[model samples]
Target: MSTVSRAPKRSLASRLPVVHQLQQSVGLQRGMLIAGLVVSGVFVLTAIFAPLIAPFGFAQRRDDAGIFGAQQPPSAEHLFGTTVGGYDVLSRVLWGAQTALFVIVVSVILSIFAGVLLGLVSGYFGGWLDRVLVVVCDAIYAFPSLLLAIVMSIVISGGQSSLVGGVFAAAISITVVFIPQYFRVIRAETVRIKAEAYVESAKVIGASSNRIMFRHVLRNATRTLPLIVTLNSSEAILTLAGLGFLGFGIEPTAAAEWGYDLNRALSDVTSGIWWTALYPGLAIVLVVLGITLVGESLNDLADPRLRGRRAVAQSAGVVAETSVVPGGSLTAGPGGLGGLEDGESFDEHGIETR
Candidate 1:
């Protein structure tokens, strides 16, 4: 009896559009996705294993005499060479991975929570609150993202060398820039979904506003955020670097950061000390590229129309393959039948003649 009662519920749930979307999410642009995953995975692993992988501590000097020479070219002792400040360029680059990871994680998480919350409220309520919030978001969005980040960094830390302060400054600045984006996405989705038939049904059935917003609308609205987060993560790395380069970033000797490292290397390039600048710059480029690729692939995946097209293509291929047997027999199975009966055709799954 219970099994009988549950079957219809399962069928209804399976038929939901959301279910179809989830089913189609996989194997879209497989090559791009695989490449993104591989590159992003390398950065994540490098950040996680920085301590074990780095040959020397980020600030460790080569000798006990505390007089290590600067600008030493790549050699057996120093693989990538030494910075003008006598720090190992390789070690600093490796440790910088940790800093980059922290900033991305902290900033993205904060932005998502704040932006989603505001977006949900403004979108669902749709009153003065919504109007006011929208205006504010638009105003904030007008500023250049990098410029906004710099201002936020200065306001937060005054450009001091405290690692904690620097991290917070970078993260919070990024959050400010991204919150409006998230808000706009979720708000628009909420507005559309709040009027959805299912939402109306939930309301008619005495479901509370909170329940409808959080339970039904939130999930659908956030489907695009993974893509946004991925793209924003790459942007965050660039912002952090920009801050470091402008002297508003992590302080000298406080921690290893690519931007700060690059700032130190600006004068070296003129004198032919390439290793100091090359490694950190390369790190930024590679990481941003990896993240951008993942985001773009994810954007493609999140589009239901694209997924639906793929599904249709697959279904068409299946039909083409199944209907035309190699021996030119129209049998449902091998040696079963010669042709379909007059005015008969197979159903979509090739079952149940009609």
Candidate 2:
């Protein structure tokens, strides 16, 4: 029997190029990853334990000095101070955390479900269904998101202005605005990935269109989805805040909404009680900024071109030289392996000749 020569085994480091590339990306540093995790953890924990974490029940109010001391600067007694309604501002703010988290979670869930479903259908079908969704999405997109939300709020409940009504209105409006973005992004990705070898192979194997589109195609196509979802949640929060600021969001009488609270304090800016508006507004900004930073870092990690620059730089450090062999021929080896002579094999062992 003839001897068999085995091919060299690849090292684990060389097997997963995408992972290596991701590690080399900007903002994929250990510090950024830790910061992102911390932000996400805090937001999630605040949402989950809002009742236990808050100093007072969101809707509960007492007829004590706390309510009378409206606009007191942050102190040991009141962390965020009191509002004009003899309500504890700190309590309201803490309670508002629940509201903000609720809105974000609800709106994002709705948006992602509707958006991804519509996107997959529009992309995969690409006919009258696509046209219909595109037109509807475009119409909603044409109206400014905040304005559309305000109009929707007014239309849905005949101007009820209740917390539940406002939340539902905001959810619907935000979902509509974001659906088009998701549809477009997913569609573009689908269009490219449908032509890939794996997709084509799946089709050839008699897999159903829905299976191929959802299980095979979408899984590969949604590498950017985490970042998209993060950014959209941030946008939803800002839109909700803007509606509250404009007097179209949660009702003023409701427990404590950051937006509604900010609206109440608008007139007091001229007075020395800047803390009322300032603290809530700052809360909105900080939350938005935190989400934005995490989203940007994820984007960097997902983008291959951005991630591979460091790998390319490292590759440039090592070099191999080549030279011509004897008898007017060329070959490649470390410091030059000579060209094969006549029928001789390139290996130095000469086992083939033997």
Candidate 3:
């Protein structure tokens, strides 16, 4: 009896249902995740190793003789070709990744920290504080995020260093956009989880409000946070790019920014020097797409509705295959049969005969 009890069972992976219903519903992990991660990883690595990877410095330019013609198509010598101003477009694009990624990292960290703090506080201590935050978020949300960024940029445009000023401006504006989302999501989740049995039990055990909210409530409610973070990261990237395009983002003097480059090249678009705008635009689109895919995959993975669907499908399949009768009418197999066909009856021999 002891040996039988101690016998090793099949691994969890082997026991898992073959057809994942949630996977079907969400349609996740069908290569979007892999492709997104691979592309995003390449971009991140390029940004990290920009100094070593770029053949030319961000400010480097060739003289007339070596600069070649403007808007030249991609070639072995000048991949992505040279811009109208004789700058290496590929090198600039590579360097711009660093600037773009830097802003993304800083702004996302600040925004997430601020949003999460405000959300936690507002949700846990509802009343005047919640009302005030709601009002503030509503006001911010009313304005277009890009317009708000421009307004903030105007306020800070007093000969300040573009890098420092632009980062500060982007961080603040992105924080405003994100706080409302965080507050709303966290509040809803908190409200639902706060009344759960575990939370009530904790309260009954004399747990403080802070302990209950942070330890028990927040912990249980955070399964959706990774998806939120991924989505917000993409939003931050778009906002930053928009600010750059409007000339309110990283200053023109900052030579390696995709937004700044795009803005500079906008006028030259008429000269058929399309590479200038095209490269940066493509970079922005790819980065945003990658982030979006990652967020979508994470959401699919975390969503219980999808998981439950997958479970149902798997159970149904198992039942269908395992329900076959050996000689007579169909009956439930070892998997604990549920579904049964009409007119099926069990005889005293423990067999079903039509």
Candidate 4:
């Protein structure tokens, strides 16, 4: 009776979207996801352990050995060398990860709550309020996102703000820009889902409007959100970098920021000093590339048309199941199949013979 277990017992945590794909994927898709995961993991760990991992403070010009000379080339003492401001490049890079992480988290959270709520309400109700919201989102989308972010950042905090102020200035500005994107996508999803049979059935059952909206509608509406999240995370990083590069970022003494590092390195480029610009710019590229890879891989896997099934013959020794129905309980008797089918019978060996 136990010969064929029903897909084993996987915890809900283990069945999370990307992790499930990461576990099941094979070939090129698997390779891309692994690479992205490694890079993202490194970025996250560096952010979490910046103070412990870094050799010096982000704004520190001196250490036990004295002041780190400006624009020093790579050496044993400073692996990534020193910036023009006499701070260790490695330390700044590590600490910058923390700042980038903060922006991504804050921006994504704010945007998700505000956008999803508005979309849920607008889509569920669908009246003058819906039309007004749609028009407002369209108007917001009409302006360039970056320009809007810049204006928001300027209004919130000008040059050389404190760490929290600067991070929030950049994050909130990004939130405003992305709210519309999330709203449109979610609103459209909600509209389509509201008419689904399950939703209608829930309504018919006299379930509270709030319960129906949240329990049934919200769960299905957010399936596509993970894809949007990955894309927006990379954009959040870019927006933070842009803010710093344009001189609206945190003060160097207040915190490390990649865009500000790039801004400070511009003069060094003409001087043929490469380390200053290279590492920070490379950090941006690698982080963005990693997020983009994860997003693309998930999107491919999510689309049945793109991630076509592997035939049993092509799967080596593995036999993949297409249907999701599980085998019967032990109470259904020694055979795993629920019961006898029209032309199927269980032989002495307990196998279903047709």
Answer with 2 or 3, whichever has the higher TM-score: 3
Candidate number that wins on TM-score, 1 or 4: 4
Number of backbone clashes in candidate 3: 3
lDDT of 3 by residue, 38-100 (tens): 778888999999999987777677654565566666788788877766667889889888887
TM-score of 4: 0.85
How do these models rank on lDDT, best leading?
Answer: 4, 1, 3, 2
Over the full model, what C-alpha lDDT does candidate 1 score relative to the true structure? Answer: 0.86
Q: What number of clashing residue pairs does each candidate have, in the order they appear?
A: 0, 1, 3, 0
Q: Per-residue lDDT for 1-354 in model 1, tens only? A: 354444334566666643433455556466666677788899999999999999888888766656457899998878999998999889999999999999999999999999999999999999999999999999999989989988898898874668888888889998999999999999999998898899999999999989999999999898788778999999999999998898888865777899999999999999988999999999999999988887887677677677577778888878776746467635553223543434455565666564
Q: All models: lDDT?
A: 0.86, 0.72, 0.73, 0.87
- Model 2 spans > 4 angstroms off: 1-33, 63-67, 161-163, 309-354
Name the candidate that leads on TM-score.
4
Give the residue spans of candidate 3 off by over 4 A: 2-29, 62-75, 308-320, 327-354
**Candidate 3 Cα deviation (angstroms), residue 186:** 1.6
TM-score per candidate, chains pooled: 0.82, 0.76, 0.78, 0.85
Residue pairs in clash, model 1 = none
User: Between candidates 3 and 4, which one is better according to lDDT?
Assistant: 4
Off by over 4 Å in 1: 1-28, 64-66, 308-354
Q: Which run of 10 residues does model 1 get worst, by summed lDDT?
A: 333-342
